[model samples]
Target: MSVKPEPVSALFAGSFALATLSAPDGPQFPALVTPDARVTDLRVALADEALTVRGLLEDWAATLPRLRALAAEDGPRRPLAEFRVHAPVEPRQVFQSGANYRQHVIDLHVAHRAPDDDRPEEERRAEAAEIMDRRAAEDLPYVFIGLPSAITGPYDDVVLPAWAEKPDWELELAAVVGRPAYRVSVEEALEYVAGYTIANDLTDRATVFRRDMPQIGTDWLRSKNAPGFTPLGPWIVPAESIADPGDLRVTLKLNGETMQDESTKDMIFNVARMVSYASRTARLLPGDLVLTGSPAGNGMHWGRLLRDGDVMEGSVTGLGTQRTRCVAEDAS
Candidate 1:
């Protein structure tokens, strides 16, 4: 007989958010987080003890009703603070969209202009703006594959590689897929999204380009694939909970100062387009994330870069927050 799978969550409003959490030095399990910071262990509440966050996502449509019923009627639960929170879901693949924000790219063009190009600042800025307009009208998104091993918890420490001269943060809104999405259209893209979460797409700016082979272009592998480079979720806020992922505010604070504060409305390609564009090539499975690019005001834009002891706080509209401290690895 086919095994019945259950999800690790339930809700407060219409649905509850899912989380992967555990006690100190204990085995991780899926649980439903409440609005009051209490959580119900899905293992005890559901029929299958082996039910997991991923399994829940894999069968989202079937388990959704049960989730609602469970949410309305509470049972045994615990405080959220008593457990160590983890990345809400473990995905086999992660797709990242780059240079998708309108204003962010324009600022980068001005900031990283050629030394000899001494055109007036306004004239240069005007040129970049026109280029972005054209791209939005007719161009494919610049999407790249990110190593899932780079995933870490919301409160985890991000170890900055000693070799990295300029470490940067790109706080973005990540869409968590529920149904298997392959070659889905933009109109149907949101239908497959189960939830949304926060992601900081950290990059080693110094390693972005391969000096040895300029013609080969950007090197995302070396620039982004470090352990704990991508600090994901405190929890997965169900897509239904977020009325519009394309209109949320993506903000990041470095230490106590606000660094990146922009709206998803500023994106050249919205969440639906990004997810649809990515699925054109790859089969996005349950738990896989389609990371919508970050908004403006990156470290480079402010003439600042990540250093050891730097604490970053990032949050997306309804998806919750992630706080990761930068730790410089000792080369010697």
Candidate 2:
């Protein structure tokens, strides 16, 4: 497929605005927002219509004019459809990184630590450095092929697959590639970004295989690919709005309870560095997505696993949120 790249300036312009979702508190004033207000997933919006801008980032920036037009219309607006959402641009290959955050590293060590033994500060620091260096040498982006079957629209129900008993939630900020990026320097990496969105990098923790094996033999697939594993949307906010991709606020709630609350500042490998490293081998095509790692408070660490009656909620600062119910495999 010959993918057309989105304009860099349009996608990475540093401007962001919070989407107003709730109705006005005062009863007298007509709702500034309407009940039919619907958020569209980038892939879905593009497939249902020929976007004036071909690339995801450019299309997102291009939609501003259309949104203004829609707001001007006197009548009700239309809601987004399920058929329109693509499997978040299934790239030929995908990569991810492990222990890419200070918190993540500390959390890993803490989990492995014996309860009674508190390592001295200096000892902890030395151990952390060793762990980080080992992870860096692997140089393998902890990426997984986001299989098509595992993708769904923003509001769609995430049906747990038959074999999946350990569904886990990971709230993350996802980036869309607006241009062909290869071997780009960290300084020039952000230039290749198009926009950003909210994504829950859901995983089947039990399915994770041994990482010591060669890349193709044991990683990626087992860690990321599962039916309805990646649920994204609300909308791809133009990158220009976000002053810093690494500093956005992110959160994930389950069944109306707040689970993860943190800022992207905690990431050990910032966006530019992450992008620069991954593009060294494969060119990041337009529409390609990069999901920054999740925070420490995931359900997997705790004994609690996702059940059928649960509802999943994930969101980013400026980008809207994704709300989906988790239905058991047999129910569907």
Candidate 3:
């Protein structure tokens, strides 16, 4: 049977669900959207082996409108609840910003100061503010690469490795690249964005710092790239749909208690700067994910790290909610 065609309204719509439908044939389609209002089933709006979803993202300006229009058409529909939601797109490159949130970095500086320094809280705040101002004025964004294998579905279960002692959650707003960006200016950065999504950048706090190699500092690979460490998606809201990425709120809850609640307005570099900074050194292709960093209120700040059977609910204003459960890795 042929997939149903999407409606024209879907093309102009600001939000759409690009999902993988579970079929006996296996996971099918990378760009399927719900054409009807009920979202019972998804229709194949765009499918190409070579370009994939990443290529479609390169021309998102044209592709999104087409997809939105397709979504308006009445074609084949599937039961939305029966299929599992994958990371909206399979990114060829993933760039995550580090210490890019104003309040978050400041909080770390204050909390991790030398015990003997004995600086007052006000002084620490002032110092941190000065440092941030200098970085913003002279320095570029700090970005690191992430393994795509670490990605999991929005509602997937996160397996806490037996070796990880302090699992933590970082709710962030992730931008989906729609066009090629290389050495682009900050003023033109947002033009490369296709849409936005939510990601929970789970971390193993205990492994963040290498005690043996203090000079080397952070060990992001070991601390942040475990399987199912990045829980992403639910939906990708078109960039046009988001009036202001900088103003959105990022909230996370541990189990049933609210843990992290902050706004993107606290970002030290903002999305445009982060994207432009990343493109300066690396060629950003369509479908590449650029995480804008998490705000303050991470588990490290609360001293309440994640444990087995813990649940994490992360949400961004326009993006969507992601619910993940933490389970202990099975010891063989």
Candidate 4:
């Protein structure tokens, strides 16, 4: 089987982003990624030989302007296509929003209706909509902690455990925190964001619910925290570049078939609310990710779950696109 690599620039527009990359013969390093697929190693650009994306994020206020200046000037650069891409940042914390998208939650409720449920589809949808409206009006966002170890490179392969009967795709928009935020207000939440990236939060439906201890709630640990479960970023597009994070399109395709394609407008709690809510209890540090939650059109909705050799391609408008092939791991 011959593999032809896709040009990294084709996945994004004419803008600048921060990414982690390595040449076929060199070590991985943070870089200034150009929409034309050229990369300027941040070490050389910043005059810091040991620079990392996390470190850049920690000093994002000072780093961003420098990155911008570098983006506009000529420097020693190599075609990004010649390098291996890695997850842009190795975050210390990951906060995941659950059922935050109105249509997404509604779709799940309707799709997972019990066998005894004989309600008309329209009635079920309407009921779900009402519940969503109530959830929207309510003050809090449903947020959960996720392990950073689960994160993988944007172009890496996802190993689906053989025991995972119903692995699914959930493409989401994740905000990258640049400033330390604690109990921040919704009006000021975006101020703490450095930028945004694409995240594909894969899940194992079979392991989601604990049949014996239903009261304990969804087992997110086993369902979502598997290694390589969260594929994040070819790069992080600066927040200043995106006009409105709330209006971007989140799209995912399976084997070239469009599966999840929804606007952030469908979100019950917007990015600000989600970020503010997350900061209320936990200290959101630099490089921490606040996943805004996945939109509708999961594998469960179409009854076509992930299989070995399936390819998932996802993107958040202007952020960039990520492609990952699925491989079934031997469970035994």
Best by TM-score: 4
Candidate 2 lDDT tens digits, 1-332: 11111122222222322121212241111111222343332223235333322333344455555544444456543332212322334334344455556566676775677778788866876787677666655554455446545555566677777777577888888777777789999899988877677778777776676546545454446656766677765455557767788888788888878888888887767788788878987787766777778887788666677888788777677665677788878834
Q: Rate the local accuracy (lDDT) of all candidates.
A: 0.87, 0.61, 0.78, 0.90
Lowest summed-lDDT stretch of 10 residues in model 4?
1-10
Where does model 4 exceed 4 Å of error?
A: 1-5, 8-10, 112-119
- Give model 3's TM-score versus the native structure: 0.88
How does each model score on TM-score? 0.93, 0.71, 0.88, 0.95
What is the model-wide C-alpha lDDT for candidate 1? 0.87
Q: How many backbone clashes does candidate 2 have?
A: 13
Candidate 3 segments whose C-alpha is farther than 4 A from its true place: 1-15, 23-25, 31-43, 46-52, 74-76
**Residue 275, candidate 3: C-alpha displacement in angstroms:** 0.7
Give the least accurate 10-residue stretch of model 3, judged by summed lDDT: 1-10
Ranked by lDDT, the better of candidates 2 and 3 is 3
- TM-score for candidate 1: 0.93
